[model samples]
Target chain A: MNLVLLFPILIPFATAVACLLAWKQRHVQRVLSITGAVLLQASGFLLLVSVWQSGIRAVQMGNWPAPFGITLVSDLFSAIMIVMAGLTGVTVLVYSLADMDTGRESFGYHPLMHILLMGVCGAFITGDVFNLYVWFEVMLIASFVLLGLGGEKAQLEGTVKYVTLNLMSSALFLAAVGIMYGAVGTLNMADLARHMGTVKQPGLVTTLATLFLLAFGIKAAIFPLFFWLPASYPTPPAPIAAIFAGLLTKVGIYALIRVFTLLFVQDLEYTHALLLVLAGLTMISGILGALVQNELRRILSFVLVSHIGFMIMGLGIFTHLAITASVFYIVHDVIVKTGLFLVGGVVRAERGTYEMSSLGGLYSSNPWLSALFLLPALSVGGIPPLSGFWGKLVLVKAGMETGQYLIVATALIVALLSLLVMMKMWADAFWRDSPGSAAGGSVVSANPVSFESRLVLFCPIGVLGLLTLAAGIFAEPVLTVCSRAADQLLNTEEYIRAVLGGIP
Target chain B: MEVVMSFVIGGLYASGLYLMMRRNILKLVLGIALLSHAANLLIFTMGRLTRGHPPLIPPGEVRVLESIADPLPEALILTAIVIGFGVQAFAIVLIRRCFETLGTDDLDEMRSTDRAP
Candidate 1:
C-alpha cells in the first residue's frame, strides 16, 4: 500500500482538526488553511504523477483482502480530479481570506472548508460504493455548516431547502446501495463492475442503475431535479458560493461518470439514451433560467447548471472520444465557473450589490476587473482561444461523428445563447450608466473595494484566468491526460485487477 | 415473519411519503424520520431472516458454520440510521430556528429564497 494515496485525504482532515483546535486564533487558522491547501496541491500532484506513470493504484485499508475490505483506489481520472480539487481548494481559500469577513471566519469557516475538501477528496478516491456514500455525508454535513455559517435569514432559508433536498438524495443513495448489495452481495465497486453481467436478475441491476441516476441526478442539478440549486447557491457568501459552484455538482457528475462507464454499461442503449434526453432538457432549462435572471450570481448559477449538460452529453454519447471530451469539459467548467463567481464577488465588493440593475460604469472605472470577468465569461460561453472552447469543440465533434445531430445542434444553440447572456451581463454591469448616478457620472470611481482585498482577490482570479488560458493554449497536455483517463475508464478490467490483485 | 416485516416496511414507506408531502416543517421532519426507518427495515429484510443465530464466526473459525443471516446489510443499515439521525436532528433544530425567526412552520411561507421580488 502506497502512503501517497492517503495524503490527499489525510492532510485536509488533519488541517481541519488543527484549524478547529486553533479556532480562537484567526490568523493562525488562516496560515494553517493556506499551508494545508498548498500541501494538498503538492500531494495531489505527487499522486497524479505516480498514477500517470503507473496504470492505477489501490490501497486496501487494514490489510484486508480486496472485495472485502474498504479500498482506496486512484486511476488517472480520480487522480486528475484530486489535483483539480486541490487547485480549487487553494484558490478559494486564498480568495476567502479577503472576501470572507471575521464574523464568518470566527464561526468556524476555515475548518469546515477544510473538512469539506477532505470529504470531496475522499469521494474521489474511494473504491467502495458504501464508502462513497459515507464521503457524501461528510461533504454534506460540512457544507451545511458552511452554508449557514452566519445564519442570516436568507441563508437559513436557503439552507433549509438545500439540506432537505440533499438529505432526500442521501436516503435515495442509501436505498440504492442497500438494494445493490442485496442484488450482488458485495459493496466494492470493482467487484460490482466485474459481477454486473453475471447478476441473477438483470432487471434488478437496471432498477439499481435508475436509483443511482435519480440520486446523482439531483446532486448534479440535472433538468427537473435542479430547482434546489438556484434557490440556495446564491444566498451564501461569495467565496463559499465560488467553491460550491466549483466542486459540489462536479462531484456528482464524477460519480455518475464513474458508475455509468465502469459498472452500469450493461444496457447502454436504454440508460445512455435517457441521459441524452436529460442532457438536452437540462441545457435548455438552465440557459433559459440564466437568460431571465438579473442578478450576477443567479445568472452564473444557472450557467453552472447549463454547463453540466455538456458533461452529461458526453457521458450519454459514451464513446472514448466523448468521455475524453467530458473530462476536458469538466476541468474547464470547474476552473471557469469558480473564476466567474470570484469575479462576481469582486463586482459585489466594488458596487455593494449583485443586481446588475443597481450597478454600472465598471468598464470605464475598472477595466482590469472587466477584463478578468470577460476572460472567464467568454470562456464559459465557449468563445475561441479559451479553455471552454476546446471542450465544446471536442464534444460537438464527437456528437457529429456519432450522428447525434440533434444534441450537437442543441449544444451549439445553447453556446450561442450563453454568449448572449454573458454579453448582456457585461453591458449592464460594466458598460451601462449607474442606475442611481447621472448618465455620465464617470463610472462611480469612489473606490469602495479596498486596496488589500483587491490585491488578494485579483491574485487568484489572474492565476485562474492564466490557468484557463494555459489549458487552452497548451491543450495537448490536458487532452492527453483526459484521453488517458478516458481510456482507463473504458477499460474497467485494469481497475478490477488493481483492486482485486489480479486473482482473475 | 418475512412477510409481516415486508408489510411493516411498506406501511412505514407509505406513511413516510405521505408525511413528507405535508406543508408543515415538523411533519416534514417526521416524514424523513419515518422514511429513514422504512429504508433501514427494507435493508434488513433484503438480508433475509434468520432466528436464534448471529453472524458471528466464532473465535477460532474463519467462517461461520451455522446458517446465520447476512450481516452486511445490517451493518449498512446501522450506518444509514446514524447518518439519518444526525440529519434529522439538524433538520429539527433548523426548523425550530426557522419557526422562531420567521414565525411560521409552513413550507409555503418559506419561499423568501425561491421567489424573486
Candidate 2:
C-alpha cells in the first residue's frame, strides 16, 4: 500500500491529462511533460530502493485480495523494468523536444508521449494477465497514433501494415487469455499457476501456449513474425522510432519471460526447445538482413531484431545464470539501441537523409557527437568494458553449461557479425568524406556547435553509456539481483503465497 | 448441437484466414473482424457445454447449482469482443487514411514504400 509504487503510472497519466487540458498552450504542455518525466524517473528510483531493501511488493487494487482483485506487483525484475522505462521516457522526451518540429509538437504529441509512458510503465508493473493485455492495447493505440503523427505518405503506408499486424496479434492475445482462463478458471497469474498444476489437458495447454508465444513473438519482432517492425519503425520521427526500437519489442520479451517462466514451466521441454531453434534462426537471419541493407535506419532495425535473439537465447537456456544474463542483456540493449537510434536521428538531421551513401564526414565536424554514438555502437558490438560484453559472456557461459553447443556457436558467430555490421555503419557514416566533398554541397548542419541542443540529446545518452560501463564493471551485484528474480519466477509457490496469502 | 457450433467456428476461422491473405485493404479489416469472432467462439466453447441451467444462482443458495453454464468464459468473451471492436475501428480509420494517401487499396502498391526501393 506504499503510494510510491503507484507514482510511476500515476505521474505520467496525470501529466497526460493535464497536458491535454492545457493543449492550447504548447509551452505549458512542454513544461508539464518534461517535469512529469523527471518526476517519474525520481519515483522509479525511490521504488527501486524500496524493492531492493524489501522483498517483492504486491498491491491488490481496491483491497480485494489477490486471485480475486486486480493486482500490481513489483518484484526486482519488474522494478528494474520500471526504472528502465522511466529512463527511456525521459531520454525520448528530451530528444523529442530538441528534435521535433513545432507544428508536430502542437498536434498533441506531448500529451500522447506522456500517455504512452503511462501505458509502458503500467504494463511492466501490472501483476494480472488480463491487465497486461489491457496495457498492451493502451500502449499500442498510442503508438499507432504516434507512428502516423507525421502523416507523410510513407508514415501512413507503414502505419497500415504496423496497425494491421499488431491488431491481429492483439486479438490473438485476447484469445489466448480467454483459453487460459477457461482452462484454469482464473485470470490472476498467481492463481493460474496454482490451478494449472492440476490441469490434465496437455494438448489444450500447448495450443494456448503457442498462441501466447505467437502473439508476443509478433510484438517482439522475432524472426518469422518480425516483417512488420522494420517496415513501420523507420517511418516515424527519430524520437518515436528510437523509443519504439528500444522499448516496445522488449515488452514482448518481458511477457515471454513472465508467462513462460511463471505459467508454462511444466512444458518447458517443448517450449524451451522451440525457443532455442527460434533464437538461432532469429540471430542468423536478422544479422544477414542487416548485412544487406544500405539505409542506416533500416540496417539498425534489422540489427535490433538480431540482438533480440541473444536475449531469447538466454531465456531458452533457462538457467539461473542464463535468465540473469537475459535480464542484463535486455537492459543493455534497450539503452544502447535507443542511443544509437537517437544518434541515427542526429545523422539524418545533419545529412538531410538516412541513406549512408548520401552522407559522411561527421567525425571531423562533431567529434563529441561521434564519440557519443561510437561508445554505444561499440558496446552493442560487445566490445570489452561495455554493457554488451558482460551480457554476452553470461549467456555463453550458461549455454556451455547447459551443453547447448550449437546455440553457443550461433551466439558467438552472431556477436562477430554484429560487430562487422556496426563497423560498416561507422566507416560509411563517420569515416568517409561527404559524397559532394569536392562540390562543397549545402549540408544542413543544425548548429554543429550548439551546446544546449547537443546537451539535450547527449546527456541522456551519456547517462546510459555510463550505465553500460557500470553494468560491465559491476556485473556481480546486478547478476545477484537477476538471480533472485529468476529464482522467484521459477519457484511458483513464493509468488502464489505472496499474492494469495499462503495459497489456496 | 456442439458439432454444429464447432463447424461454424471453423468456417469463420477459415474465411478469416483467407481474407487476411488477400491484398485488398478492406478485406484485411474484414479478415480481422471475422478471426476475432471465431477466436471468441472457440474460447467460449472451451468451457464445455452445459444444459438445463441458467448462469445465475438462486437467491437463497450459498453455492452455484449443478450443471450451470460456466459464466467466466462468457464474461471474458464479452470483454474481448469490445476490445476487438475498438481495435477494428481504429484499423478501419487507418486503412481509410492509407487509401487517401497512397491512392490505392492494393497491398502491392504499398509494398514499394516499406521495402527497399
Best by the DockQ measure: 1
lDDT tens digits by residue: candidate 2, A143-229: 998999978898988888898889778878877887787678788888887777777786777677788888998998887999888
- Model 1's CAPRI class is medium
Worst 10 residues of 1 chain A by lDDT: A439-448
What are the candidates' interface root-mean-square deviations?
Answer: 1.4, 2.0
Off by over 4 Å in 2: A439-451, B47-71
User: Candidate 1 on A393-497: residue-level lDDT in tens?
Assistant: 999999999999999999999999999989999999988867766754444533577788899999999988988899999999999999999999999989999
Off by over 4 Å in 1: A439-447, B57-63
Fraction of true interface contacts that also occur in model 1: 0.55
Q: What C-alpha root-mean-square deviation, in Å, does candidate 2 show against the real structure?
A: 2.2
TM-score of 1: 0.97
Candidate 2 local Cα displacement, residue A267, angstroms: 2.1
